[model samples]
Target: MSKTRQHCFDFGVPPALTLLLGLWGITRNNSMWRDEAATWEAAHRTIPEIWSLLGRIDMVHGLYYLFMHGVFTVFGDRLYCLRLPSLLAMACATALLTLLGSRLVDASTGLATGLAFALLPAVQQYAQEGRPYALVTACEVLACWLLVTAVDASNWCHWAAYGTTVLVAALLNWFSLLILFAHAATIALARTPRAVIARWALSASCAVLGSLPLVMASQAQSGQVSWIPPVGLGTTLNLLMTVVMGALGAYLARTRLASGSVRVSLSALALPLLALPPLLLLAVSLTRPLYQTRYVLFSQIGLALLIGAACHALASRFRRQPRRSIVLAAAVALVALLPIEVPLRSAGSRVDDVLSTADNVAAVRKPGDAVLYIPAARRDTALVSPGAFTGTRDLALIENPRQSNTLQGVEGTPEYIRKAMLTARRIIVVTDDNTSPPASARDRTKEQVLRSHFIRRYETRERGRKIVVYVRRADDRAATPTSRCPCFVRKGSTPTPPGVVPTEQSKSNRTQ
Candidate 1:
């Protein structure tokens, strides 16, 4: 390590930029997406309920739910309140990246690394989300910092801290433990004293032991990740891009730096951290579909460090011949990416704008309205913003999700739902845009009952969800009060309920 003075400017600028960039549109009141809505539903519940819910689903996010539960208790369930932890964690990760880069190379390299991390699109995206990925990323960087310190000082306390952070990171998101494999690879490639190696081994063993319960429990809840598809060409391309960036960075830094040892050490440290976890995931996913970009978001830190090193190296190589031009070019490149960042900061970036769907439905809703979620999993919309569906009866719901200690609560059986559907004249159906007729017998029954009996009235489509209004056909309407909904149309200055469209200058209006 270089014995250089820590410049205040270098130390202060990265985190400040990170915070400003992070808070740019952090307060936007976009309706929470499915995963975030899941967090909101899980965290707002009582501790016992959260625990019980974890037993059945999302055990991997148990610690995060507990943490957010405390945060909600203190801050309330506002948009900023839910996402602030992620913003702060991202800022912290940026700062730690600066420190890690500075330790591995120089102050300038560290500063550049921090700026690169702050500017990363992935970093910006996760920073605004209300999830464990950002927190786990921060913890991963902090653990790496502890590892560097322990290796340098051979201190027992530093190793213990590293072990504790490792366990905490894994508990936050069990997949974050993959960073340990990268760290182990880094240690194996670097030269270290036997005593330091033993202490490092001990710390890693402790982390594994401490994380075992979460590992086991999350495995039991593995169905939560059933959506992740098997690895294919696209997956390979993504991992390759990550590795290529890291390799380019290492090559640039090595060519520019004077010390071979520092160049070799940084390459060993960064390359594995950048490449190993995702590739390992790809290999494992061939049998057990467990690959997701966010699962190894910590890899971005490694890539950022490499980019920073490369930027610093370029500037260093040209320092004697007007370095200002190099800095200007780097600034311009980062500034150009802001256009891409703008959309990412908005609700429109998401597949489902839940708030927009709610607003559209609210506009068309009327008294005596009933609501149903197609395939049932889409019920989070109502839970996310219950006020939007205040007057509407949830046709399939047998209990409130929170009270039932479930993601979106249990639904009535097919026969029960079919009976409930018949009683309501106006029904609003919520469904995923990609949903097809259900394949299971019970789900098929629900689908058949709706399509065969009701006439489609109005349809509103959003990015990832669709809301359809249905009315019983005129032939199916009976004299019973439950058979017809009140109408908005006025016939010859006298209001009449739907299913009784009067003749002679009939008014056409939407029935609620």
Candidate 2:
């Protein structure tokens, strides 16, 4: 193969494959989980509304929300529009990784590295998500590539670009700042020259300084991530496996390349990139619960690089039989990954499907019915599918999400909530299926009121969500068979209470 054709194959194949994988079942059967619902709600809001929302919560995702607002404006607010940017960003990340591998090692290693990255479960998962992590991952790779280039040439422009890219990634998610620690470890391991090290320090410092405002602003909203659990046995095992795999691959590739052959050795770069950020995040999580694997999604790049290097080493070892060996390895990997890949594109794959919950709500709701969102964040279901809740009142809500510039909207106090619940004959409660204790005093209060004041009449579980109907104990006994309420009563269903009338308007509205 000619150099140009080889270069094209190396750079082109991985990203194209990534795009293909991303586009396959991109909608997840038309389901939008709560997290994606948050993105959709935020992006659909006016620009000023998004800005106002950032002031109160999710400041870290401000830039991404704004970017998506533009995307929605241009392409219209379809699921395709919501997730396409992430797909394209992952594709770009794949291309950048290919370039990084080619520049640092051989073309074969670059091709393998890019292909590995594209096929990674984490990468594939995020690539199809509507969130900003994939974009952050792309920026992280671009910054890494620029760092390699800057180290080689020691140019101001390269350092500036690296700093700017880091800033952008941090703006997308402040946790991405953890990558700087990994980069520092890479420079130290490579025994970079004093001048280049100084330049790196300056660039990194500038990036941090640029991101300081978001850091400070996001601290006030730390409660948003208060739900993140502390690292545990499962997390430890996953991290251990990741590190072991990278180390084994690094060991395999060590003999094939001289440390002095490249300005920064691939092992030096890939090892810390794989291991440090997640380890550091988990370490901090010990004192303050802040660890979530998705936060360090960029670390997958390191693993992919190591895998590529390992493949290159194996190819070198079996020069005459390289094709057969590579084909066998690829087949084993694909077969192993097939089960996971198939489910990832399914509606039930995510924690909770907001659209499914909305459909359930629409099916059972009547015009004058009241609704409650336990833990409140489940209000995202209503936010994304407002039509499902057309005539229902949010009994505990003080203001709607957009009006309050909050993700879940502000809620009334416990006393107010209790008083409001007393007025409703039938209430719909949307909550998770898990029996875990409520996360907040408000949620506990909601649960307590439901248990004490209302009788659980009907309940159904769908896609990790539970929609339960609670009828007031006083109204439950005054039931008539003539009422057409769908609260699934086993023998004699609870009828609409006197003065609480069901209207054709609600029925017609739900149909629309």
Candidate 3:
């Protein structure tokens, strides 16, 4: 080999290599996702009492948000700050995978494992998210180190560490336990042995016992699982296939250039690739809960391991025939992944569009004008959060102001025109609505509900968001600068939402 080639062959420093790899994957896709918007909202919280406010949301990843608070504090909350934690956590996950693989197999296997993990679009997407997926990936891999140790030594500390991993994984996202179940099932099959298994079981029980306090909190607070669209068998299978096959394709791409390696690769890949997916599918099915591809990120390492195994199996198959495993793997990955990445990224684009419109809405708030927001259908916070006018207190979120602020839900049919004509001041009505009622007040069409209620007075198009401001009248000063406004703008630092009681904010006599 040439000297330059030989120099390139030398493995670089581990941490930097992981950092560079993670950065590449994260930046490869820049689209935002729905959950990411929520993270951005949480990370940009402003009230001193935001921690209390955040607790009400039932998001399982409180620790992730706290760290994000610190990041936003320094970096001045923006997309990068929202995304940086996931990026760094992916780097850490890669390093941990390398460590775990090296111990289980060898240096070559470890490097191959890391390389495969780096190319996965799923990993890249989550790694750039503002949520907890990447960090959970890191913890899952680290737990493996302790699990392997506990298998042999049966020591208290090792067992304790293994259990601690279980606790952390469960707390971050309950679905994380799905991966734990997969690993536990694999252990129970006598693949390793009986006596060692018994020891691991006892250790696991202790971990569960220790975690009872935290888990109970979840159980006590657990409301009825939210409504989920019925998932067919096809969707369930496709989700599994995508996670498994997509990961394998990424691994194959990473290791296609390898010359000779079988044992090192297969062992490293077997545990993750073959074990995690089906088990997770079964778990979700039992609960009848909604299942999306990203929720399984906690078990992604297992998928990487599976890909490593596939890499060896393919390489060996091709070795004798000399056909085209590397070429085939590359072809398959691009075909399977590129198509899916487009739509997934499209969903992310929609999320960005939502935020952009929010910025547009914020830019147009006139400081004291009545801010009328008719949430055409459901009360989605994303649409409303941006309506908050960038952290100011001068806006009132009005549903129907033509009626008295003291008036609650209307009972009798006074009619839509009466409601429309009651506002006699300068006001802004914004709706991406779908509410349809008889006696159409604004009448754009059948599909367009709120379009009929008010006439467009001011429209601002900026940041991918369209703020179509409407009003009943052109002259009334509808709001005061001292009233509370929705919080939809970027923050100057990391913050949390204020925990102002809804009742207090809604009191009829409190407004100016």
Residue 466 of model 1 has an lDDT of 76
lDDT for model 1 comes to 0.78
Each candidate's TM vs. the true structure? 0.89, 0.91, 0.66
- 185-233 per-residue lDDT for model 2 (tens digits): 9999889899999999999999999999999999999988877887899
Which whole-number lDDT from 0 to 100 does residue 2 have in model 3?
A: 66
Question: Candidate 1: where are CA atoms >4 Å away?
Answer: 1-6, 255-264, 321-327, 475-512
In model 1, what is the error at residue 311, expressed in angstroms? Answer: 0.9
Point out the higher-scoring one by TM-score: 1 or 2: 2
Model 2 per-residue lDDT at 35: 88
lDDT, candidate 3, at 237: 77
After aligning candidate 3 to the native by TM-score, how far in Å is the CA of 203 from where it should be?
2.9
lDDT of 3 by residue, 411-437 (tens): 222244235334423344444423334
